[model samples]
Structures are given as C-alpha cells and as structure tokens.
Target: MQSFLQVKHVIDYSKMTHIHLRDFYASLNKKPQPERVKMLLNYLIEDQRRIEKILSTFEAVSEPYILDSWMQYVSNVDIHGLINNQKIKADISLDEITELAVKFGEVLVNFYREAATKTDLEKVSNIFKNLAEMEVKDNLKQARAALFEEM
Candidate 1:
C-alpha cells in the first residue's frame, strides 16, 4: 500500500476533494438521520461530479501550472483538518451535518475567491471566479433547504 504522502502526491486537488467528501458523507451513512443523509448525499455526489468537470477543463488547458497552483493553494486550507478530526457519532443531528457542509463549502469559496484575486492569468481567474460563484450558490441553496426542512 502507498504511504500517506505518496498517495497525496499522486492525487490532484479535485481528487483530494472527492476523497475528503466521500469519507465525510460515508460517516453520515450510519447516523440516526437517514433523511438528512439522503438529502446531503445528493449534493455531495453532485459536488464530486462538478469537481470532475472542473478537473477535466484544467486538463485541457495549455498552462498546466494553473491547476497545480490552484490545488496547492487549496491544500493549505484548514477544511481538511476540520473534516478529518471531526468526531461523528450515531446520534449526530442533521443540523450538525448541515453546519459542517456549510463550512466545507465556505472553505472552497474562500479558496477560489482568493485564487481569482491573486492570479494574473485571466483564464485561471475566470475559472476560480466561476467555481467560487458555484460554491456560494450551492451553499446558500443547501442552507435554506435545511432550514426549511428542519422547521
């Protein structure tokens, strides 16, 4: 089996995001709130697909460093630690899951927003802006839906 650093070295940002998300969502599978898990699962799956699309776009680009730099920048974010260190129990509430999901999206938004502002390349900046917009829109939609559902 590959070492942790070895596995990390081979995976790009999108893949890393996928791994983290999949693990987090899986943690909810055995929780008491099946309905909440089902609801969030839909979004998580869609999020992974969207990331794959973004990665494909990056693969088609001339400047390979754009994707690399974006990935490196995101890796520096603390969301990974938050997710990995979180302790989820079978009794965890939907509100807890919703909060974590919101924070997850916020981290992505911040990363992309920062990238958009920092990059000199218009292509890179546009990609980052688009991603940031997408993340914010989804986060808002999810939060509103969860609020209504909880009521």
Candidate 2:
C-alpha cells in the first residue's frame, strides 16, 4: 500500500474518468448477454484508442517505455478468444466474474506502480503511473456497472 502511494506521485491520473475495463473480460463469460458483449468490446476499443492517443502525445518524450508496455498489454489481449468453453443458455451474473477481475486489478495496480518507481527515467515512471491509474479507473467503471446491474 505504501509503495503504491509513493509510486503514484509520478503521474497525473484522471480520477473522474470512470472506465469499464473489467466488463469486456467479464462479458466473455456466459453470464452477460450478447449485447453486453458488444458494449464490452466497444469499451475495450475506446481504451485502446485512449492508449494510442496518449502514446502519440508523448512520442517526443525521452522515455516512453512505460506507455509502450501498457500498449503491449492492451494489444496482447486475445479479444476474439472465448473465456469459457461451456455454453450457458442463461446470463451469468456480475457477481460471478467481478471477483476475479477485481483481484487481477489489485495485483496489476500494484505491479505497475512498483514497476514505475523502479524506472530510472522520470518520463517512464510518469507513464507507468498513468497506465496504472487508467487501468484502475477503467476496471472500476466495469465493477460499478456490474453492481448497478445487480441492483
């Protein structure tokens, strides 16, 4: 916790940007409707675009490794791959998948921040911090929507 707080000082994160980062992964499961799947994909694409824009914005920076790494993570996700082999006729509840995503979020949030702090370049550290914050905000949006769906 202390490490994250310390590392977070490297970048300016938009706390107001509530993104639904987890929804796309969660929608891969059997619980969400097909439309939900579409929504997830759209959000995912939007995030990708955001990352790209951020990268382009800082292309002139001396060290953009952190932004590069984040783009790799986003680009590496197998979007077409199905998350579950079993075909369920019913929609899977948000509760079923949120926990897994939240757990991943917790780990990633810490990992990126720690990684940033270890970087020698200030620009790299700042990008990592931004990436971490973006991930958190995006994931939280999904978690929130899921909770709303539950209600």
Candidate 3:
C-alpha cells in the first residue's frame, strides 16, 4: 500500500509553459508554409488562453509573494520533460501537431492529478484538481476541433 506523506512542494509551471509555447510559436512563425504557421498560431493562442485560466486560479487563492516564490522554484523541476518529448517542427502535419499538443495537455493533467493526490493540504489539492480538470476540458475541446477538421 502507498502512504501519503506531507509534502509541501508546490510547482508553478506557468512560466515554463509560457516559455515553451513562445519558443514553439517562434519556430512555427519562421516557417515558410503560411497554412502551417496559421494553424500553429491558433494553437498557441488557445494554449495562452488556457495558461491564463490556470494563473487566474492561482491568483484566486494565493498571495503575490507566494506565487512569486513558486515561480522561482521552476529550476527545481524538470518541467520540459513533463510537457512533450517530441521536437515540434513546422513541416509536421496538422494531425502530428495536434497529437503533440494533446500529449502536452495530457502531461499537465497527469502532473496536476498526481500532485492533488500527493498533497496533504485540502486547499492545495483542490487547486491542483481544478487545474487537472481544466486540462481535461481543453483536451476535449481540441479533440472536438480535430473531429470537425476531419469532416
């Protein structure tokens, strides 16, 4: 049986995700293919919107000082590994890009869900649970969009 330990580790992945999305967006922006660039720009915009939602959640329950400190703890985490293992390129098909984006969302959901389960504080757990649920909803929206594109 697994034991629940009182771990006070709170990771703020907002900065990391922003940087990752910016880097990916920049790469896509440089591509010669207009259609691909447009597709990725749309993806990036939606990603930014979702990140804002997560940040808003934190704002609702956390002080500026605590949130600032949590942001600084990004170095302690291997966040890039959690997002996606694939190197995104502009040449990739829309389906491939969608798959990669979905994978990133999945990782976010899994990370938050795990954190929610591991935390000793109800408030912290609930925050993480909410984040996970948001990610799930975002994934469903992406799936629906993909389905529409297929039709």
Off by over 4 Å in 2: 1-91
Candidate 3 lDDT by residue in tens digits, 43-127: 6666666676667665667755443322111233345654445565657665775686687777678767776765455766676
- Candidate 2 lDDT over residue span 50-81, tens digit each: 75466445554534444343321121222123
Task: Give lDDT per model, in order.
Answer: 0.64, 0.48, 0.60
Q: Order of all candidates by TM-score, from best down to worst?
A: 1, 3, 2
**Deviation of model 1 at 119, angstroms:** 2.3
Q: Which consecutive 10 residues in model 1 have the weakest lDDT in total?
A: 1-10
Candidate 2: deviation at residue 125, Å? 0.8
Error of 1 at 149 (Å): 2.8
State residue 128's C-alpha deviation in candidate 3, in Å.
Answer: 0.3
- Could you tell me which residue pairs clash in candidate 1? none
Q: In model 3, which residue pairs have backbone atoms overlapping below 3 Å?
A: none
What's the CA RMSD for each of the models? 5.2, 9.2, 5.7
Tell how far residue 75 is off in model 2, in angstroms.
18
lDDT of predicted model 3: 0.60
